[model samples]
Structures are given as structure tokens and as C-alpha cells.
Target chain A: MGIREKPTRMDQVQSWRADFPVEYLYTTGVAGERFAKTLRERGMLAATRCQRCGVTYLPPRIYCQRCFADLSESWVEVPLQGVIHTYTVVPVRATGEPSQSLEVIAYIRIDGTEGGILGRVAVSPEAVYIGMAVEGVLAPPAERRGAVTDIRYFKPILS
Target chain B: MARKRESSPQNPHDVGRVMREIPERPRGTPLKDQDIREGKVSLIAWKPHLEYRWDSGVAISRFLLGLKEGKILGVRCHSCGRTVTPPRAFCEWCFRPVDEWVELKDTGTVNTFSICYVTWDMKPLEIPQIPAVIEIDGTHPRVGFLHLLGGIGEKDVEAIRRRVRVGMRVQAVWKSPAERVGAITDILYFQPLE
Candidate 1:
């Protein structure tokens, strides 16, 4: 007959903390700063236009890549309606962070605009589709600022 | 060339005369195939780690600063009459130079949006967050952006839609002064019109 020996525990569980350091540096030109200030005080959206191609961007720019020409200040107002381009639903949690359930994401094309914007989908994940009309929702007066977050997520425009 | 005869050394027992002995070869240990396969070997555990530094352009920096001041800014293309929110220094369309500044009305409508249950890192947020695309008023074509929505409950999706229609009035909600930074975090979220 053979004899067998029982295994013994060798290591114990332990916890420790480590520091995570991150640093960020950024710089903005004079024209860009002025553009942002205008939005903050005026509650407006601005973009740069191509002098040669006649194309307008939602977020304004300084130089024209096509014509390589210096753009002149010619601010114009745009409509607040658009169509849905694409969408998705996100449902995942991060490690060592808060937990959430399903989330709706979408790409929206503003009315009369050629480009599209990416953000959260306010509608049901199952209800979203391409070519659906939508619009922007601005923040309160007290909360109004010349920032992207100034306009909350776009909700489906029923009327 | 002269030839020479070979001569022997005076010492009869010289070290060079003796044959050098070779070292013995190492012996191999024999073992069963099963025993060798079942044996355990030491290993080191490893985990993946990554780091990055984002470079936001000058235009983006200004836009973030504007958010800190509670504002939404866009740039305009003088040649094409287009307005861009989250202002860009250049125009992507028509390949032209955009050198204009336009301020958009806070009152706009929802172009489209999503209710975010996850954070920016693709992880679940502690609380469900609403992200939407809003088109600013008084801009050529339709100008829109992505942001958080408020003044509506999580289940009240329809109500939020009604309040943030394509042309409904809406405004931005800013964070406290102390917490204000020249970044998107400046504005906590946007609220429905009263």
C-alpha cells in the first residue's frame, strides 16, 4: 500500500495601491480662441467655410485646404433639423469603476448639412434607424456656455 | 635549404611524452515519459498596460475654454456659408479656406441622440447618462453636436423627445465656477427649454 501527503497553502492574498499619473498639454491659436468666446457669450454655433469650394463646416476652421486661401469672417446661421445616419447600443462596464446597463449611440446628419455628428441616441435602441429626422436641445440660460456640451443629446423630432 | 636531424630531450619521463587523458562524459538520467510530462515548471504572470497623450488642436482648446465659460461656439466658412460647432479652424468641405466666426443660438432641436449607460471609456457609468445630437439654430444647413441631456427621467424618453424637438428651445447646464476647466467637462449637460 502507498501513502499520500496532503498539499499545504503557500501564499496569502494581499492588496496594494499604486499611483497612476497622467499629464496633458494643449495650445489654441488666436482665431480659435475668439471663435469659442463668441459662442460662449452669444450662444451660437460657428464654422469655417472654404473660399474656393464653398463648403461650410459645423466647427469653424481658419485655413482652407482646397484653395489654400485665407478665409474671411462671414458668419452664417444654420437650421436645427437633420436626419439619422447610423446608431448602436453599448452595454458594458469598466474595471474598478461605476456600472451601467444598455446605452444608445448614433450618428446624426443635420438638415441641409453635408457632414454628420456622433453622440448618444435618445430613442430606444430598437427604434433607431437611418434617415430619421432629429434636432438639438440647448441647455438653460444659467448653464449656457460656448461649448459642445451646451447642446445636450439630440432627441427624435416628432413634429 | 639545410636539413637537420631530430633529437630527443634529456629527461626520460617528460610530461610531453605521456598521452593526455580525456574528461569523462556526463551521464544521462533515465525517467518515464509520464513522469516528465506531469512535472511542474515555474512561470511568471504578466499583465498588459498602455498609455497615450492626446493632442487637441488650438481650435479645440478654445472650444473647451468656451465651454468652461458656459458657451457653445462654432466656426464659419466665409466662402461657403457653413457653420461648425465645436469650432474648427478649417473647413472639410469644398476644400476651401474658412475664415469666419459665427455664434449659434442656444435654442435648437434634437437631430438625434442616445441614452448612454456607459462612460467615454466604453464602460458602464454609475448612472445612466443621456447623450444627444443637437443642431444649433440660425446656422446654414443644419449644425449639430453630441452632448449629455437632462430635465428628463431615464424612463421618460418620449417626454424628452417632446421637450427637445427638432426646433424646441434648449439650453446648456454648466458646472460650478470652481470646477470650471477649459474642457468639455465644463458643461455638465444640456437641459430642456422651460
Candidate 2:
């Protein structure tokens, strides 16, 4: 009914390393359909607008959370340019191993959109700063997948 | 004649009237398969990886350690006099904790099996995989764990696929100790002995 006290570290702890592989497919419902379609065909970013609340979501949602209104087809193509809202420089991978070089991640709010998208920053970490102007760099048209990766990364827009 | 008074707040008669007045639910324009195939509608596909770890805990930790030493172990329920392989800490049948651990033979008999022509991801395989439940010799007759079957009937006749069946004797083909990590994978697969 009760656990006994551990005699020693070796007696109490034993671990077996295992790598169980799992994969899944995520569906981006009604709102995502319009957003992804625009990205794949026109290489432009789209967002959903809540008619009642006046809130625009970049990773478009199918409904307004606050009003519970269905946003089935309210799509808008905002400019593919924006300023960096925030950023981070990480020299370590998700697994905690040291990366060959630092990776800069930034959230870029496009010119005409209220919210911004979080994506990789291709520019050097030293060159990255809050409020820096940047633009999306898209993959070749033929190679474009209907995913965020289609926009390869964002780079600094020099004057 | 008796007249009805105003209804109680808890029992609102107007709820059904409101439901009858509301519009029916609407379905979105469903994207047909052709829309995705022909680029008529944008369809994004994502492959997400779920990386996770599970702790084997007390009973399984000891069982796996035994496997590293090239032995199979089971927990014994002294109350029911039954031994279960792929050991459990408690007995479901007897509703009591197992009394002791018993080492079982590496050899076993096939309880049931399947010849798989495809991989888990639904990819067709050139050679079919033989997955089977092998009941260990020293444990209870009906108790067993799922494993694959290999080394069936002879190379001369090539009749292994035809002859492999339930109740066929088999043995564990252990990986070399150097490569034997403390896991179920330490014993690669079960092989038909006769």
C-alpha cells in the first residue's frame, strides 16, 4: 500500500532507451482551405476576418472564438511584406544538440494584416532586430507545396 | 375553468419556440477529391512527428534486464498457480499480486499468425512478414505475446509458408549480447524449430 524508501540510486533507477516512431496527418478545415489554396496558387498570404468582431486571423480559423460565428469563406490576401514583431536566436536544435550555426526565428506582421506569422529568418542573427522590415522569400513556383514551407523563409528588406 | 399562471424560470416554455425559429445548421462547400487533385482548391498536407518516451517501470524493468541476459521471464501467481509471460505485476484472474518471478524457456508454440503483404504505412512488401502470437513453454498454455515467425519448413522444398500453422514449436532468435539493448527488440523474432 505504501512505497518503501530507496536504498540507493542504482536500486531505485533503471532506464531503457527506445525510439518509437509515430506520424500523423492534420487537416486544416474550411478556413484553412481558402488560405492554403491562395498560398499555393498565387504565392500570397491570406487570412480570415470575423465580420462581427473585426478580428483577422493569419493562420485562419473557421469560426470566431468570441462570437462563435462561422467564418466559412471570409478570405483576404494581405501584402507579403511586414516588420518583425519579435525574434529569437537559438544555436541549439530541438534535441538540445549544438547546431552548426545560429537559427533566427521571427514573427513578421505583414503590411495589411493585424496578426503575424512565425517563421524562420534567413538573415544573420546579428542583423535581426525588433521592428526590422522583412519580406517573404517563396520557393520556385513549380516546387511550391500548399504549406507554410512554400514560403522558404523571410529575409531583411534593405533600403 | 382553471387558468394557467406564468411558467417558472426553471421550466421555460419559450425554449422550444426559440429552437423552432432558428435556421438549420449549414454545411461548408465540401472540397471534392478532384478539387485537390486539379489544384481547383488549395489543399495543404502536413506530416507531424510525435516523439515520446515511456518508462517501463518496476516489473517490466526487471523483465527487460532478464532479456538482456538471453532469458525470458514471467510473473507467477501462486494463488492460481499460473505463470504469465510478457510479465505483469498483478494477476487479473486471481485479483492479487504475483508471488514470484519465473524464468520461462526461449522456445514457444505459435497460437495464431498472419502473413502480411504490406508494411504498416500500407506500402507493398516483396516478401510477406509473418507475425504471430507465441505462447512460451513454461508459462500458461494460452498466454502469449505477439511476435514474428521465421525459419519455417526447409529450403529444399520451400514449403515454410504452406506448413507454418498454429501449435508449431519455435524459439527466440536473440540478437548478440553486444547489440542486445534492454528492450523487447533484444529478441529479434521467433523461429520455427521443427
C-alpha local distance difference test of each model: 0.61, 0.79
Best candidate according to DockQ: 2
- For candidate 2, give the lDDT: 0.79
Model 2 ranges with Cα > 4 A deviation: A1-30, A36-44, A81-85, A89-104, A109-114, A119-159, B1-58, B61-70, B89-97, B106-109, B125-127, B154-194
Worst 10 residues of 1 chain B by lDDT: B39-48
Best by TM-score: 2
Identify the leading candidate in terms of lDDT. Answer: 2
What is the C-alpha lDDT profile of model 2 across B99-139, one tens digit per residue?
A: 78788999999999888778878998766778899999998
| Interface RMS deviation of candidate 2 | 4.7
What TM-score goes with each of the models? 0.38, 0.62
Q: Which ranges in model 1 have alpha carbons more than 4 Å from their true place?
A: A1-159, B1-46, B118-126, B156-167
